[model samples]
Target: MMKNECSVVQDVLPLYLENMVSEGTTVFVKEHLENCSDCAAEFERLKSGRQIDEAAPQREHDTDVITAVKKKIAKKIFKIVAVVCLVFAVLFCAVLFYTGISYPVTKESISLSTKTDSEYTYIILETKAGKSLFFESKTEDILNDHNEVCGRRIVLYNVQYHNSFTKNTSSMSWGKPLNDEKPYLEVIVELENDTLQISNAE
Candidate 1:
C-alpha cells in the first residue's frame, strides 16, 4: 500500500486491534497487514501496550457498532412483545363487552349513587322497540320542598328519583344528617335481561 493508504490503515489500527472495523474494512486491513510487517508490528505493539479502556482511540466507544446492532435487535423484540400484549388485551376487552361479562377494566357498577333530601329526579327508559319500559308512579311531588342550602339550590333527584311510587323522607338513611325528616326517594338499580329495576325507594 502507498504511504497514505498505510497511514489511513494505521489510523484505524486501534479499532482493528479491538475488532471494531466494519467487516469489509477489516478484510481490507487484514490483506494489508499480511503484506506489511511495519503495520503488523504496529498492530502487535498496540495490542500488548495498554489495557483496552485506557487506550482511548481516535474514536469513542470501540464496540459502538456492535452494541448498537444488539440494542436494535432487543428493541425490535420488545416492540413485538408489546404489540402482542396490547392485541391480546384489546381482544379480551372486546369479547367481554360483546358477551356482557366484566373484563379487567370493566366497571362493576351501572348505577350511580349520591344522597340528599333536596331535589327530585326520574329516568325515562325507552326500548329500541320504542316502548316506555317503566310505570309512572303516583308519588307526592317533592320539588315543592326544595330550598337553598348554604346558598345553593340543594338538588335532590341527584339524590332522589322523581318517578317514585311513594316518597318517604324519614326512612332514608344517608350516613349523614339531612335537613329533612321525610324519606327522600333514591333508587338503587339492578338490571336483568332487557328489564331494569329501581330499588331502595322510600
Candidate 2:
C-alpha cells in the first residue's frame, strides 16, 4: 500500500482494535498494518498493557460515560426539587399572612347578638360574615355549661395589636353560654382592657 493508503488504514485501527469492522475491511486493514512499519508501531502503542485485564479499558470508558450521564441527571433532579420547595415555601407564607391579616381576633371582629328565635345565642365572628355559622351538628349541647367535658370550650389568646396569631399571649379557657331558652346569662369575654359584655337586651 502507498504511504497515504497506510494513513487511511491507521484511521480505521480503533474500529479494528474493537473488532467492529466488516470481515473484508478487517482483512484489508490487517494486510496494510503488516506491511506498514509506522502503522504497526501505532497499533502496538494503543495495545500498551496498562489495563487491569485484557478488556478493562473498554469497560472503564463505558463507566466514565455512565458516570457523566448520572451526574447530569442528579443535577437536574436537584434543581427541580429546589424549585418545588421554594414554590411551596412561598405559598405557605402567603397563606399565613392572609390568615393573619384577614382573620385577626379583634374586638371589632366579633359581635354578640340574640337571634330573633330567642332559643339560640349567636357568637358572631367576622370569619362567618354573611354565612350560616350554625350547623345541626353543633346542637345546644355545644353551648351547655353542664356538659363541660362533652361540650365545647373556646380558648382565646391575648393578641397584641398588629401581631400574628403565632405571637399571641398565653391562652385562657372560657365556658360557653348555656342557651336554655333564656338569654339572661351574663356574657363576658375579657381581653386585657377590652371586654365584650353582652346581656339580654330587655
Task: Summarize candidate 1's per-residue lDDT along 85-117 as a digit string, tens digits.
Answer: 999999988766644432221113233344434
Q: Ten consecutive residues with minimal summed lDDT in candidate 2? A: 131-140
Q: Poorest 10 consecutive residues of model 1 by lDDT?
A: 151-160
lDDT of 2 by residue, 68-183 (tens): 99999999999999999999999999877755452334566455554334344444323223221211111222345764434332323443333243532332122234554433
| TM-score for all models, in order of appearance | 0.25, 0.39
Best by lDDT: 2
Q: Residue 115 CA error for candidate 2 (Å)?
A: 4.7
Candidate 2's TM-score: 0.39
Instruction: Give Cα-based local distance difference scores for all models.
Output: 0.51, 0.57
